[model samples]
Target: MSVRATTVLTHVTASAPILLFIEENGACNTTYNQPPLLILERYEEEEHLNLVPLNRTKHPLCNYVLTNRWPIDQNWLYVDDEGLHTKSIDREDVSIAFMPVSQIQVELNLHCGSDLRMKRSLSTNGEQNWLGPYDYGANKWILTDSISYNARRTLVNLIVKDINDNSPIFVGLENEPIVVGYPESDIEGFVSPRFLVKVEATDADIGENAAIMYWSTDPRVVVSPNTGDVHVHNTATIEDNYRFTVNATDRRGSGNTGSIDVLVKLLSSEEIVVITVQNSFLDDEDQVLSALNAAVDYDIKMLCASVVTGNIEPTYKRQQSDDLGVSLRLFVYGIKSQEAIKVDRLTSDLSDSNIVTVNIASVLSLQDHLDKLQICPLPGRDTGLLVATIVLAGVVLIITLTVAVCFFLKRKKEHHYDQFSDRNSLASRNDSIKSSKSEILPKINLDELRKSEKKLQERLDAANGSSIAANDMLPVIIEEPSKMTDVAQTPKETLINISAPDPKAPIVIQSIDKLKDSGADSDDDDEFGEKNKVRRKSVVTFNENVEKIIHLEDGLDEESSEPDIEVYKF
Candidate 1:
């Protein structure tokens, strides 16, 4: 089933327009030479015309404009001047890509079916071909991907909607332009002409259709392009009719303009300067007065005073009065300036007009204050805090390094001590063990002890065989002191080699105690063989356990025991 369709590439001068309808079965049916319905239509695009599908019957989903309303519903989506919009929609499963209206034809894709469905056939990417031919009579259609689709096909419908819907509106206007300034009243110290009047407008359209630009037709008046802000000439006089029209135009151009008639008059222009006096301390009223006098001399337009307690930084001390014109700031700070005064000059803020700082310390007298108006002393510049901070940081660093070094040295010493102690204990234990091993042996020499015992036994035997001599016997005779006899005086001990007595021989024994008692003190002691040849002899007898004992071989009886007995030698 072939159908006839009109293309934008060429125009046919036909009496009636034709339309092609695709049926549910794979059939394309055409209706030609349709009776024309009268409708007024206009197209600014002269080169081509794009015919859309179902352009008339599609109704807006809402009663009035709901874009500006708050607390919208959740389920359904709405379309406004900003294109399609949804209140709260999930973007995870279905993603939305925004493109301009001109790119609609290029982005059009037919998925499972050529028709638009809320569920299936929503969108396909750029890789797939959008739509092609189907069978002539088949009830269902299929794609190359073997996806079965309902053959009821609807084309990609281009919505012929959201044309130029609104015009610009003007905001906040007086009956006529107010007399903002006077030409003759242009005094140097007044507050009237230092003001700004604002003129503005708004548009509710979206995108390029909503951007409103502004301009003025008159030479005396000027309008800001972006904000529609109106600025008049400062030198405007009252004789001039400041009447002019301010026009606001949307980006669509042509008939989208909104305008308002404004009549402005310049009563006069006066250069008024405001002088703000900021001071504290109730006792400094005299200083404040002196400052005010200085302002009067400089033609200060506005004078004020602000009281504060604590100190303020120099940078933030200069208040920004961009709306106010040229003014002087006299900061009568009650702080003393002996040690802390250090600044010379600071940046002046002239965002709107030039502003200068006048110090209370510099304004001692009227003449001094006058000289300072043209040449104010610069703000005090102090760097003591920064320098002190740097010094403190350096000291901390030194202390930290010293502590670290000390800790390292202490650890090293402790490690060395542990090693030394271990070595010393091991050495001492080793020496003790070695000494114990050496001492586990006999104390005496075996050979020397055996020889000493043999010598002692031999001596015992030799002393048993020896005998005493006969001369070893002593006779029992006493010598008197009166007799000068030459005899051995000391009692003598004679060692005589004597044999053992025969077992039959009797021994003669005498008590030496009786002989010692009977002293022979005879006067006739020298009468025996003359004095020099005296036969006086002290006799010693035999006894047991004595050194030598005399023995009579046969002359003496075997049982003789007497006191003061004598024995003779052979």
Candidate 2:
């Protein structure tokens, strides 16, 4: 029960020597050149011949031969004995035929009168010959060496010998040394691709004298050196079965072919579908939002998802939410809580009137999407508080200023009144002096005062004629001598006294100084009294030089027939 049968040689030529071979047994024998043995035995005395002549030239020894005899002819004759009592005799009808030999051992041992070896004997007379067999200890067969044989070498030296001569020969592989390299991958097909493949072959018997030949199941594959590099002329196929064979040869025309079965199952180009909602009315149109949707769909489709940042949005924050969504779908196949999508609002608050505006940005990522997107409005109280504060400040400032101005004006008025009252009051000596002087000051000029006494009397009469009782028109008088003396010290008083009183009117003094200056005498007064009906009397008397005026009760009697000057002090 061998798994495989050995190569068999079914046809043998009759013109050549035919050999019977048993490969594993290592034994063989050659066919004889002539038919060797056959003889007949009678079964019932009717004698049957088992021999037949086979005239086929291709097998000239197909017939069996029993005796070395030809066809015989005979007639009846008497037997004769030599010279005594026997007569001469002849027997004629004879035949040459063969019958099958029953025992091979007996036939080989049978003695025959005709010697077939003697027909071609070298010696003239028949003689027995002896030969000696080789007497070595024993014949033995051994293998001294082995080699790698290709089909051609095995066919010539090993295969042909095994078939034609029953020789003990077989093909063997020597395990030749070889160098193999994987191809470089980057180059396209066979043109110095990044993936490189190469092989160098060598045989033990030939050293570097080994050549390589290659064949591929795929025509698109190209092998460099036609024998070594397993290069892909075209891109490797993904779904096909391919085989590559490398035939390593020796200088002796021996070759060994090894094959490799390759399943070139190249993956098909990926089907990538990027979905974008170009029309965006709100944040929903953002790339992140769109990408999120894609994640859901892609997850359902069992496709990988990824977010690709592009010019539309470069950074993570600037990236459109929709694009982020898509990228998440691609990378994670869906948006997970851990990989949250960051949402950024691209908005402008035109209504906000602050000179500086706030920029709102948010990161929507696995960790912070929901947390970052929460928006809170500014408190309303702040605006009102600012305006109210400004109004209150303005009002307070105005009131304070008003109060200051009023206080300043009132203070100024009080000061002015105090100064005026201090200068104008009657209790003040300064004010009293001014009043007294104003009352006593006469309207008369000094040059007019120097007129003739008659002219003065006429001017007095003229002045007295228009006044009441003429006493009111008189000069003011002073009761105190000191006050009277004080007025006399002024030059203006000398001018007022020069005008004499009129004889018909009484004199009244408006100033104490005028009274003191009046010289009242009895004889002059009697003369002036007869002419004048009224007289001005001084309230106090004064010595002629002392001028210490004292009031006189009746000593200066009204009927003393003297003119008196009446004096009064304000």
Candidate 3:
């Protein structure tokens, strides 16, 4: 229902002023037409009514009303057939209803109950017309009212306040607990400017809520509240691994806190002596270690050395005549400070020698330096074992080759000897065959035999002409080759063939004078005739007898045959 007010005046005059009354559905009311002044009241935003103001301005009428009358108590109003009324307005017969209106009208409509209670509604886009999260600043909100043919819109601004709701969280260190390595100070009881690690965290809140402060309870380390940088303290010991909790807290209200695990590794206080030596010294590990130990004036421990080859910084100086030389790097540890100085001095003195340079560095810095140079530490034990295995294998190979060569030489020698023996055996067999084909006997010297036979014949003739009787003399039988025959005769008149004398027959020789002086005589004429017949049988009898004597002188057997002639007959 709509309320309509009609102005009624009892007297109207320009100079006396016009008096007017308000009538609503025939109900009278007191009214005075002063100067037709329009009053606009300024109102602040009310939480319960959900009434927000876009632009509010102070007016003189609102101040005059507020200063003259007591504050209006908020009460529920109802509309009836008489008009819009309240209990206080019924008693005083004076009521003013202040209804908000919009400056711009649109096509949308907003419906409210008679009690002026607002309910959530959806727009044409099917989205609920509601407020979003509260953000600090002026927030714009559009309120629409729609009727059958027209709609009105009002613009309202909302200023949202802030509240501590979000907690600070780590930013970069999200996957695992942060692990950082820091070296302890080389000097005793001193703290170095070693940046351990940086921890970063962020908060989803704004203003004072996003301001994070870092803190740690670990005694060995300290965290920068503003920068989140963790630093090691002087009390931190070497070779220690420490774990601590770092908290990030915001600065709003009862601050929301976030915690993270951080691991800090404190390295040892050892120093490294980097020695660059010529490649010639790389073969003998003992010599290199000894020289290094002597130069440093300290005993080098085992497994504390690492060898590498590469282009290193601060190389050795070379002359024009020197060839390009490779460098071997030796990284030695376990030496104290005093020895490190000695090493430095020796390095300067031996700069032009096999030792190129020796540099002393802290463990951390040296590691960084090596990393930049891309030099890796060689494992001493593994390298040594590999070298030993290679050397042993080489030695075994050499021995095997030597043995193989010796065996080959021995086999070749044996083969040559067998060939020589076969050739010699074949030659000997040919000689034996030739010797058997032509049989040879002992040679008799014909000239010497004839000479001796002539001498013997002369002796026999002289003996026969001497006083030895025919019976006393042995008959010399000389048989012709044509007259040789086998004949049997009386023993007193034996016949002999003198052509072939028996080589084994014995002959007796005596002096012809001695035979004559013996005076032996023959009596029987038959014996004398038989001697004459035997002598006539052979012309070479004396020759054959002489040959028999020569055969005896030439070493023929004597006892094999009896005498062929009788020299002296008894």
Candidate 2 lDDT over residue span 1-570, tens digit each: 112223246453323232333344233223332223222222221222212222345333232212111111111111111100111111111121111111111101111125434433532232222212322223111111222221111100000010111111111223222212221233123222222234444332212223444454556566554445556666553232233444433332334444433322221111112222221222332344444444232211112223333223222132333432222221111212212111111111111212121111221231232233234323576678889999999999999999999999999999889877866565697668878998896565555444533553443454534332334343333322222224234322211232444533334332223343322231233554552222334322221122222232222333564334433332
Q: What value does the lDDT take at residue 213 in candidate 1?
A: 84
Local distance difference test, each candidate = 0.37, 0.30, 0.42
Clashes per candidate (backbone, < 3 Å)? 23, 79, 10
Arrange candidates, best lDDT first: 3, 1, 2
Model 3 ranges with Cα > 4 A deviation: 1-151, 184-194, 252-254, 267-570
Candidate 1 C-alpha lDDT tens digits along 503-549: 43433232221122122333234546542222234444332323333
Sequence-dependent TM-score of model 3: 0.26
Q: In terms of TM-score, which candidate is strongest?
A: 3
Clash count for candidate 1 is 23
Deviation (Å) of 405 in candidate 3 = 84
What C-alpha lDDT, on a 0 to 100 scale, does residue 270 get in candidate 3? 38
Cα deviation in Å at residue 158, candidate 1? 4.5
For model 2, the stretches where C-alpha displacement exceeds 4 angstroms are 1-381, 384-388, 394-398, 401-409, 412-421, 429-451, 454-570
| Clashing residue pairs found in predicted model 3 | 106-151, 109-146, 110-146, 474-566, 477-541, 478-538, 478-539, 478-540, 478-541, 479-538
Give candidate 1 misplaced runs (Cα > 4 Å).
Answer: 1-162, 171-198, 206-213, 224-229, 233-235, 238-244, 251-253, 261-570
lDDT of 3 by residue, 1-570 (tens): 332333245353322232344434454322211122111112222222212211113211111100001112323222222222222211111222111221111111222333122222223223212322323123122222221211122222212223456688896456446555444456323323335667888875555767899988888778898998877665765354567888899983249999888664443433434455444344655676666566544444222234455444444344223323454545444333212223343344334334323332121224444565456545786699899999999999999999999999999999889877855688887988788766765566777778867776655454434321233333333222212122332122122212222344433333221111111122223744632112222122222334332211111223444423333321
